[model samples]
Target: MSRLRTPASPAYLRVVRASAWYDLAVTAGFATPWTYALVHDALSSCGNALGLGALPELDLWQILFANLMGSVVVVWAVLRIVGPLPEHGLFDGIARALFATWQAYALAHGVSQLLWLFFGVEVTFGVLQLVPWRRGGNACRARMRNADHRSTGRSLT
Candidate 1:
């Protein structure tokens, strides 16, 4: 896909959907305390072995917040996968920026280095969705023109 393609383009829509899939795959396990405990254990063991500092014992507040975030992200990911609208890309990009910033803050505070993996993916998707891909190219122009025609009680061939 061309980096400069409009958000309305198929390429851009696919990018948005892909990000949603990534989110679903990574966060779905965090939606419940049981699953989150398992995930937490796995991460802690790996981090410790790699000298990356294991997560502290899961606290009640931590589990609550994790569950909330996981539930919200799962629903959001489902929406994007079902209907990847151009506007969704914009909003998701903004959300990614916020996530990346928070991830950075956590890293600074000595969180496990494993978080850097997620942080990198967030930054990449954030840039991909945030780039001002608007209003150019034959494909986008033709699609928009068709929509405009339909809105005006006409049809384009």
Candidate 2:
């Protein structure tokens, strides 16, 4: 049996791009202290409004980590936004799985309930991107087989 597989479906790739947009929009504020202050206040207000615990005050070390994470995620988001390839989704899906794991760990360790919202989105997009959705699976296999035959100077049919 041929080992190669078809690329992700167009619909799935769209979902991947959508997830990247969400990441960029949400994390962009954390990329800088100036913007993070605004985002932090907003998140705190939101959490308080919802009766969820607010994020704690961050020291320099915490701020540095937040800035690093935000910068990395923002760059990753731009990559998918520009290219939106099937492979991008696969890698992004894996990253989301890791992020979701860490998020869950934080929630269990008495982190803010606001994290639940992000956790939900992470799980959703992660699963969507992780699913195997080859474009016309059998057709792709047949096409590949035909190509192989053509290379060998033979006809598959």
Candidate 3:
């Protein structure tokens, strides 16, 4: 059977393209600073909370090293936003950033009682993103199928 072509509205296509750009900019902008601040603040607070006398004296080198390690998260967040991943979807981008942030936190802080909080948040967001939502998978599959069918049909005709 000959396939019918459905015309896409220019406005819709523009919106879709714009969404990817926007997601890249917004996710990277927010995730980088937020991760940095959260990691630094949490560590500083934890030191005080543990009654470590003069929390500022709790090894400046270790604190700097941990913060530097945690900054690796910004790289992942940027990659998730601007790399090959589909950027039009905000949820996946956010999930990726969250996971990266948590992973960085875990790596910087090492396995400890407090690290569980970061791990839990990261795992929850990561798992939620992996879940199949209504029409989500279908839309992706349909696009791929359409492309494949078009390429094959062109060759045949």
Please state every model's RMSD to the true fold in angstroms: 4.7, 6.8, 10.0
C-alpha lDDT score of every prediction, in listed order: 0.87, 0.82, 0.45
Lowest-lDDT window of 10 residues in candidate 3?
1-10
Residue lDDT tens for model 3, 24-139: 43333333444434545656588558653212333456545545544544454444445433323335535556656866775676544455444565555443333332224455
TM-score, predicted candidate 2 vs. hidden true structure: 0.80
- lDDT (Cα, tens digit) per residue for candidate 2, span 6-82: 33466767787899999999999999988887888899889999999888986788778888999999999999999
Candidate 1 backbone overlaps, count: 0
How far in Å is the alpha carbon of 128 misplaced in model 2? Answer: 0.2
Point out the worst 10-residue segment of candidate 2 by lDDT.
1-10
Candidate 1 vs candidate 3, TM-score winner: 1
Off by over 4 Å in 2: 1-7, 133-157
Error of 2 at 112 (Å): 0.9
How many Å off is the CA of 105 in candidate 2?
0.5
Clashes of each: 0, 0, 0
Residues 1-157, model 1: lDDT tens digits: 4653678777888999999999999999999999999989988998899888788899999999999999999999999999998778888999999999999999999889989889999999998887744434355446667878989988565
**Once superposed on the true structure, which residue ranges of model 1 sit more than 4 Å away at CA?**
1-4, 134-157
What's the true lDDT of residue 86 in model 1? 75
Sorted by lDDT, highest first, which candidate order results? 1, 2, 3
